[model samples]
Target: MFDIPQLDLKGKVSDAEWQTRVDLAACYRLVAMHGWDDLIYTHISARIPDSEHLLINAFGLAFDEITASNLVKIDFQGNIIDENCPFEINPAGFTIHSAIHEVRHDAMCVLHLHTNETIAVASLEQGLLPLSQYAMFALASMSYHEYEGLAVNPAEKLRLQQDLGMKNFMLLRNHGGLTVGKTIGDAFMHMYDLTRACQIQLQIQGSGQPAVLVDQEIVDGIRAQANIVHTGLTGGQKSWPAMLRKVYRTDPHFAR
Candidate 1:
């Protein structure tokens, strides 16, 4: 469907980088499968292990079209590291991911999407109410960033970092949602909880009925409870394999 050239990096790159590429590619496919992709707009980025360079989608390819080797590698300044890569990344798209990646060393993967439900919830003054169990997980470590037109300015990076602080989830007011995790799976899981919370919130509001919010105590303690439930195996680590399986069943070429 697309005229993008294919490059095989399986043997060309280190085993660790190859794994990151495959996982990031699978993450893109999963986002598309969930109908959360905004064409080629939003980005999901992964830091190259033990390196300053990161991997992101080659700008023009749709989520489903992304393959492991086709992912673009770049430095913190958004310069494409591979001269042979026939794709140019969207500078504006990288602005948000780059900002977060710069300050959050623990954030190995950063996922951002512009789903309608997230935009609606973020636009509200209340912002991500603890109305569902999903919301509780999100509210446990959520932050909000006021939309500042397009996030193209380098100056905006500092403010975004400051607003995000140590939070894993961020609702970009009137914009979209962003999640950062120590791994690609963790980032995807965070997005899942956040997107579902917004979807449920919209459904309840649209019904025009009074909504029941979760207790503040429960919301406050959700992290500890989640830790126990996911004990030796975190939610993402457990669920990611299933996610990979589903994606593979759909089309295994994402790993390329």
Candidate 2:
């Protein structure tokens, strides 16, 4: 009988925002379970409702090992709210995530992963080619940012934002992949799509098979379809808490 520290969410957060955190956190663990986590390197963030702050995982914690209580409340400047989780914020993580949060108000959740395929694809001279329907959606909505070492410098934020304008997705050249969604579900879904697209692109590149980039018309159509994503992740309307339940099944310390 292990006791998990579940967030009551009865008063602190609007019902929607609390659930977004839970689902966004779940998506983090799911990323780990799917072998997408790089120890403490990558990050997932969910914008706090009625506020400019976001719920981000404490730096140094592995994604799968993250829990709701372990999450940190950080403002756009990376100033952490005085809370229970004892850890320093990853300035670089905040630098990258906060930039998106400031501009993409629609982005309720943001996910950035350094999956191997993503890194390989990022390093490629030709980034994210439109080969499949997924690629079409990706290339249509995705933006590109050149890497300037670890994303800590404030100077890089404007450039990063410039590259990520309006699109909500980006391939950080020579780095990895990033996705911002109106909901945690949408962000997670976008990550899955971009990750798969990168994998296929890398595999195709390896095979030296000529990738049949989808037609421009089809690419535009795919973008239109992607726009239609009904993000159930709308502030944890039904996601984060459910995933937390799964974490509880494993161990409840995360909520503490």
Candidate 3:
């Protein structure tokens, strides 16, 4: 039931664009592997290198069903850019992703997901507390955007861009979570940290025990500490290769 025709874009597009497609498709499969996908609802989008065109999954396909060649390419205005690409993108996905891409040139990939943990945390008044080491990574660069319905309104684009200004991690109030990165792996890792933070928070809350919050001093210095921990490897460059290997081991067809 998940069979999707391969467009065999290996040679049809620029080498960089093709690589972006493969990585973006890997991101989707990784999300699925982690049980983070909300069916075909949330989106993970990547910018084609040196181009305004963006890549997103076709609206009707589930995350596990996504493949490199099946992803639809579209412009800022949500117009399909791939010739005879028999697929359409989600308008809400375009609205959220395009708003961020238009303003944050550094954000080559924008990953959004509707995981229950994130939604629950975002709905709370506190919104992602400093309860765990995972939370510190997100808190170091977090932003929150109050939910405004379904995010399809063009008028909300400016507001989203403003709310997410220069922040890599975002919690959409009453909705889900979003992360931006200089590459697909960076975006995936950001979401990974955020999701874990939310998951830990909910577990503590459910336990009915007092949560030990991370010290403000440590939280404030997390960015520098993260650099030290990663040892100058920024933007998930250090971890992405391992992530790609895991995805490839699971299914190599995502690169098609």
Candidate 4:
């Protein structure tokens, strides 16, 4: 029943920054629509194109409540860049998101979620298996980061960066899932494919029957073909327009 405070920066920011805000806000709304939101706990950070400043949701706002005008702009060290911004960034979210953004220069967006199915899969000792095509897609660029308590400590950044390497998808062991993209849409789609793969894995495991795993050679071939067709951020751009249309139909206020 809480109402978010009014935030209007329509004429204050540059055109590129405003568009980044809108896209990042739309990403939050899409995450909520997909039922991946964990109240106000999770975080999604997007870079401001050519700037070092990044956009993140205020710690207390629900994903659906996030609007373009409401996201806080912060620097790499988690300092609020906008003096007028009232809300503080989440400390833990900062430690996690900023670490990736600090080194992953090519990544424009970093999405971390704690959905039930994704957590379940992350808790598995064997990690995600390629039981389906969705799983294969995830396995293509996925890596695993061993969980280290609250992730608020700065020391954990080194290990996290090493574990993540150049992978786009990361399974935070005993924690949750992570996806980094050259664009917001790419990050969202990465999480979507990972979430689906986790759901399918859970369903298959629940059936108590032996599952057929895809051949590694075939999996590698398909991954190569996918790379050939979808290069860099182009993969996300292909479906981003449709995603924006879906978000607008669901609720246009996210872009406000």
Strongest candidate by TM-score: 1
Put down candidate 1 lDDT per residue, 26-110, tens digits, no spaces: 9999999999999879999999999999999998899999999999999999999998889999887789889999999999999
> lDDT tens digits, residues 1-256, model 4?
5666888887789999999998999999999998999999999999998899899999998999999999999999999997878788899999999999999999999999999988999999999998988888789888999988998999999888999989999999889999999999999889999999999999999999999988878767766777777774366788888998999999998887
lDDT of each: 0.93, 0.77, 0.94, 0.91
Each candidate structure's TM-score, on Cα atoms with residue i matched to residue i, is: 0.98, 0.85, 0.97, 0.96
Judge candidate 1 at residue 65 and give its lDDT: 94
Clashes of each: 0, 6, 0, 0
Q: Is candidate 1 or candidate 4 better by lDDT?
A: 1
Write candidate 2's Cα lDDT for 1-256 as tens digits: 5343344433475676666566766777778778999988888999877788788877777787676556778888888875654677688889899988988898888899899988888888888888766677577788889889988799998898888999967888889999988778778777878999888887777897766767788787764464355342342344545655776676555443
Off by over 4 Å in 2: 1-17, 226-256
Predict model 4's lDDT versus the native.
Answer: 0.91
The weakest ten consecutive residues by lDDT in model 4 span 226-235
Backbone clash pairs for candidate 1 read none
lDDT of candidate model 1 versus the reference: 0.93
Model 2 whole-model lDDT (C-alpha atoms): 0.77
Off by over 4 Å in 3: 1-3
Q: Please report the TM-score between candidate 3 and the true structure.
A: 0.97
Cα lDDT of model 3 by residue, 1-256, tens digit: 6666667888888899899999999999999999999877999999999999999999989999888888899999999986698888899999999999999999999999999999999999999999999999999999999989998999999999999999999999999999999989999999999999999999999999887888889999999988898898874898999999999999998899
